[model samples]
Each structure stands twice: as C-alpha cells, then as structure tokens.
Target: MASSRGGSGAVGRANELEKMSIEQLKALKEQADMEVNLLQDSLSNIRTATSRLENATTALNDLSLCPQGLLLQTLSLSVWVPRKSKKL
Candidate 1:
C-alpha cells in the first residue's frame, strides 16, 4: 500500500523548487536586457532605411515628370498646311 499512497512527498519536493538561484535570475535579466537593446537598434536602422527610401521615391517621381514636359514641347511642331488644289 506504500506505493499507492506516496504522492505527498513529491509535492513537498516540488515546493522546494519554487525559489530560484540569484545567479540564474540575474542571467535571465541580462539576456532580456540584451534582447531589448538589439530590438531597439534594429528599429532605429529600419527607420533610417525607410526615410532614405522615401527620399529616393520622391526624387524618382520628380524625374518622371520630365517626359511629360517634353511632350508639351512637341505640341509646337504641328503646323496647319493649306492645300491649293482643294476643290471645295
């Protein structure tokens, strides 16, 4: 019957494991801090890259209008010619 009623000692042993070592806690905190710093650095780099891309997109849009400007210049080349042989 000892094997059928021996779960209380296991529970008491589990309660003893509730207190963690200071070194383990410190290591966990340091790892969390490092992750936070790395994420902040990544976010900063992303902001920088996004700002540069926005500037490049704006420059591309401004340069794309060049062809339209040339089209306006070409409109002056159309000249009306009168035909002398018109039967009207």
Candidate 2:
C-alpha cells in the first residue's frame, strides 16, 4: 500500500501538473527557456577562458625548453652571479 501523507512521487506531481491552467504552463515554459539561455551563455564564457588558459600554458612550456641565457635575453632581464675564488 502507498502512504498518502507526505511524499508525492512522480504520479502525484503529474496529477498536480495536469490541474494547472494553460497560462500557468506557458509561464513555466518561459521561465525554463530563460534558464537554458543563461546556462548556454555561461558555458560559452567558460570555454573561451579555458582556451586562453591552454594557450598560455603551451607558450610557457615552450619558453621553459629554451636555454636559460636565451630566455633571460628574450625577456630583457639580467642576473649577476658571483664566481667562486680559487683555492690557495
């Protein structure tokens, strides 16, 4: 036997939906359409950001494989290191 008090499963929900007016159904459909549009826009922005990040990562990896001296020159930065003194 099904308990009738609290939990209304799919059948109960379907019965409730069948009682709604056409205008109410139209409003619900419009709301759902807006939600889908918003989600699509968000997904597009995320894909663009992901593409940019991947490009940046690839560029960095390429730079890493270059010799340190060339890398420093390309970036126009200089580093000075002291030489060790010869033993007496």
Candidate 3:
C-alpha cells in the first residue's frame, strides 16, 4: 500500500495554497479566473469548429453545395439537422 503524506505532499501543497493569506489568495484567484476565461474561450472555439463540421456534412448530403464550397466558399453553412428516433 502506498503511504499517504497525511495531506502534506502534492495534495497537501494544493490545500495549503488554497488557505494562503488573503492577498495571496486574491492573486491566485485572479490567475485562476484568467485560466477559466481562457478555457471558456477555447471551449467556444471547439464548439464553433464542431458546428462547422456538422454544417458541412449536412450541406454535402443535401447537395446544396459542392464539397469545395465547404473548403473555400466565403459563406458558411450553419444549419442543424434533426435526428428522428426509430421505434424499436
């Protein structure tokens, strides 16, 4: 069995970090907030990419435009397809 540091090792360090003085905690909070904002922005970008991919696939299937349009057309297709549930 692995010996626990009684919350004094890496986990302990993280706990201590959360309990630092107000000033230090505030600084940490600012950094964490910035990181959260960055992650949110990244998540938004990923969602956008996924949306574009889905749109392109739909357009291609609909024969609305050539595949080249998805790669080079200035306009973007941004429609969603509704999936129907099959009755078992």
Q: Residue 62: error of model 3 in Å?
A: 1.9
Model 1 residue 58 CA deviation (Å) reads 0.3
Model 1 lDDT per residue over 5-47, tens place: 5777777756654565878678877999999999999999999
The sequence of per-residue lDDT tens digits that candidate 3 reaches over residues 1-68 is: 24566544879788898779999989989999999999999999999999989877876676564443
Better of 1 and 3 by TM-score: 3
Q: After superposing candidate 1, which stretches have Cα over 4 Å from the reference?
A: 1-18, 67-88
Give the residue spans of candidate 3 off by over 4 A.
1-11, 64-88
lDDT for each of the candidates? 0.66, 0.72, 0.72
> 1 or 3, which is superior by lDDT?
3
CA displacement after TM-score superposition, residue 9 of candidate 2 (Å): 2.7
Worst 10 residues of 1 by lDDT: 71-80
For model 3 the TM-score comes to 0.55
